[model samples]
Target: MAKTIFITGASRGFGKLWAAAFLEKGHKVVATARDLRSLDDLVNKYGTNILPLQLDVNDRAADFAAIAQAKQHFGSIDVLINNAGYGLFGSIEETTEQQAREQMETNFFGLLWLTQAVLPVMRAQGHGHIIQLSSVLGLVTVPILGLYNASKFAVEGLSESLAQEVKAFGINVTLVEPNQFATDWGSASAAVTTPMPEYDGARAWLQAAASEDKIGIPEATVPAILQLIDSENPPLRLLLGKQGHPWTRQVYEGRFAEWDAWQEIAAAAHGK
Candidate 1:
């Protein structure tokens, strides 16, 4: 079946890779980027099968407009992939108010607006799959990537709730939680705050712990993503890399141990 997939941030990273994959598979793609020119090759190669649009997901009006345009162009949208987000690399103390606001605007609010815009369309059709691009940081935190973790964590919670709410409408939601990959997330598409001297030790520790071998290849995720979108029963949450499951398990196991140890105190605190 040739499905129509509406995806944001299709200029690069996993977004571009997946867009090309779908087109190659004879599916139609409405690929969006902040800069329309970034999608020139795809537009040229795929021709009528691909609609390259300029979209800044932070703009609520633009999100609605883009959805309308896509719905008008393609009779129906089979899938919506929220892959537009950038990383904010900084400690909590180093992060400024403006930077924090901007991160939330694009990462959380942007996805929220687009999802809201697409809901009516999906409801009318009575079928759709929404794929949210989250991160391993959403499950477990790292030292310097605080804001990025916060944004993904927000997506995780929102998508979980959305999955339940839309199930009766025949709309499925899936959270794709990817670990570190060979993507532009940390380099080209990231914002870095001014370094504070107080966090130098923590920065050194983070740097020392970095391992290039652990980074998964971005291209490897396409098949899994395609399989997910094609399935009649997709998971509410899907972890993308080898480390995501084990790493999250360890983190949660510790949480469980702590909660169990303090179970008596926690129960006593509940007043009748």
Candidate 2:
């Protein structure tokens, strides 16, 4: 079935690809970017099927207004892809307070505001799907991506709670934890901090290990997203890419093992 899908950050990267794919599949796409002019290619290719709008996810009022315009234009939004976040690369100590806040504002709070705006429309219609673009770092920690990790971790928790809360309204939420893809995400969409000598070794090693040649195909994410949307019982969390699954499993299993090892100590604290 052709549905109205709204995607943020649709000027480039995964957002642009998703918009193109959905339009190709005969779906109405409301594609939004900070600069409307950047979406010229999408507009040209998809024509009337694509509604390109200017939206800065950091702006709370603009989020509501953009969503309102999208709903008005499309009549209803069946799927909302909150893909308007960027990566902030720096250790916790290296990242400034302002940087951290800005990261959360776009990646976490922005998603929350947009979701809030769309919920009423979906509630009234009694059906909708909200797809959150998270990262594998949301589940496991890395050296230089502390702020980005924290932001995605917040998305993970928020989406899980939202899924449980909105199930009664026939609204589904899915958190997509993707591994590195061959997109400009690491370059264009990332905010890098000034380097500090203290963390130079680890940071350098990580950077050297992250070769551009290793990035997976960006289109690989589309099939998983489409399957999730079509699913009658969509999972709350969907880890994309082969690397994400194994890495996530390892992290979770290690944590579980540690917890089990301390089970006696943990249980004793609960009772006399």
Candidate 3:
């Protein structure tokens, strides 16, 4: 079956690659971004099958409108990829309250609103898939990237619940956890906050970390995403990159083991 996909933030990076991959597979794509200028080449290449929609996923109204418009244009949307997210890298103490909120609004709430907007139409037709672009950080928190971790963690939870809630409706949800991909998403969205006097000595450490992360390439991720889309029994969570797999497994297993170890005490405290 030729799936109709609506992908957010398709103007560049992984989002762009995903859109192109779908188009190559003879599927219709409604590729959206905050700006459509960069999408012209894609639209020209794919022609009618590519609908370049200008959308700020953070804006509830705009997101809803874009989904509605895409549905009307494509007749129906079989897949929705919530890939419009950014990396907000800054220590908790250095990150401003507003910056943190903005990060959540875009990376977390944006997907939430878009999912809600598209659910009804999918439910009515009784078939759909929602793919969330999360990160390995979603599973394992790291220094200087707490906000991004929090946002993706929220997405991971949402994707899990959505998978179960909509299973009866034939709606599937898949969460993609990519390690470090070659995307401007890292450097372009890097958040630099006021250096804390307390950590002045560690500035070199932070800078070196950022420089190394910026070198990762993004080609491997799109293939995995496409495979998930084509898979008959897709995994609820698809961890990308060889490096990400073991880390994700360890983090999840460690958390579960810790929880199990404390289960009796927790249960007693809660009167279970």
Candidate 4:
């Protein structure tokens, strides 16, 4: 059963691969990028099924226009994937306020605006899936990447709440958490200045830990994403790489365990 799909940031990275995978599966894909020229190869290959459109998710009017065009082109969008985001790495003190807000604007608010734009269309059709491209960083906070982590963390919270809100309307929300995957995201991460000369040693360690070269097979995520789209019951959170599984579980488990341990004390303090 081929369905119409609309994806942002389809010029490259996971968005590009996902667009290709859907096209290969005989689905109609409205692939969008900030520059339509970057998607020329995909346009040439898929021709009719792949409609490359110019879209900058941060632009509210432009994003709405893109969504309208997709609906008009494919009748209705069965799947909407919000993958237009970038990584901005820096410590809280080292990064400027403007830089921090910009990160949230692109990674968090941009996704929100797009989701809002597509919701009515999905609800009108009676069913649709919305996929949000998040990062393992969203689950855990690491050194130096505070800004990037904060942005993704916001998405994690947004998706969790949005999932419940739209569940009644037959709309599903999925969050994609990739370990490292060979993408240009690492190179695009914001460069932060080291305020303290003494922290030089720590900064180097953070850089190595966050390197993109350590991750493998960026294409692996696309299969899981597609599987969720096709499944009758898909998980709200989709962890991409095997390397991230244990760590991600541990983070949540550890936090829950600690919270449980403090429950009695918390209740007593609140006069419960």
lDDT of 2 by residue, 1-272 (tens): 99999999898998988888898888999998988888898788889999999988888899999889999998999999999889988777889889999999999999999999999999999999999999998999888998898999999999999999999999999898888888888887889888789999879877886777756898887887777877878888887877888888898999999999999999999998
Scored by lDDT, model 4 comes in at 0.85
Model 1 residue 148 CA deviation in Å:
0.9
C-alpha lDDT score of every prediction, in listed order = 0.93, 0.89, 0.86, 0.85
Clashing pairs in 2: none
119-177, model 3: which lDDT tens digit per residue? 99899989898999898888887677788999999999998999999999988889988
Candidate 2 deviant stretches above 4 angstroms: 212-214
TM-score of each: 0.99, 0.96, 0.91, 0.93
Report the poorest 10 consecutive residues by lDDT, candidate 4: 188-197
**Per-residue lDDT of model 1, residues 1-272, tens digit only:** 99999999999999999999999999999999999998999988989999998999999999999999999999898899999999998899999999999998988999999999999999999999999998888889989989888998999999999999999999999999999899988899999999999999888877675588788999999899889989999998899989889999999999999999999999999965
Number of the top-ranking candidate, with TM-score as the measure = 1
- Model 3 whole-model lDDT (C-alpha atoms): 0.86
The CA root-mean-square deviation of candidate 1, after full C-alpha superposition on the true structure, stands at: 0.8
Model 3 misplaced regions, further than 4 Å: 200-216, 256-264, 270-272
Per lDDT, the best of the predicted structures is 1
* Candidate 2: 10-residue stretch with minimal lDDT: 206-215
Prediction RMSDs, each to the true structure: 0.8, 1.3, 2.3, 1.9
Q: Residue 125 in candidate 3 has what lDDT?
A: 86
| Better candidate number, 1 or 4, judged by lDDT | 1
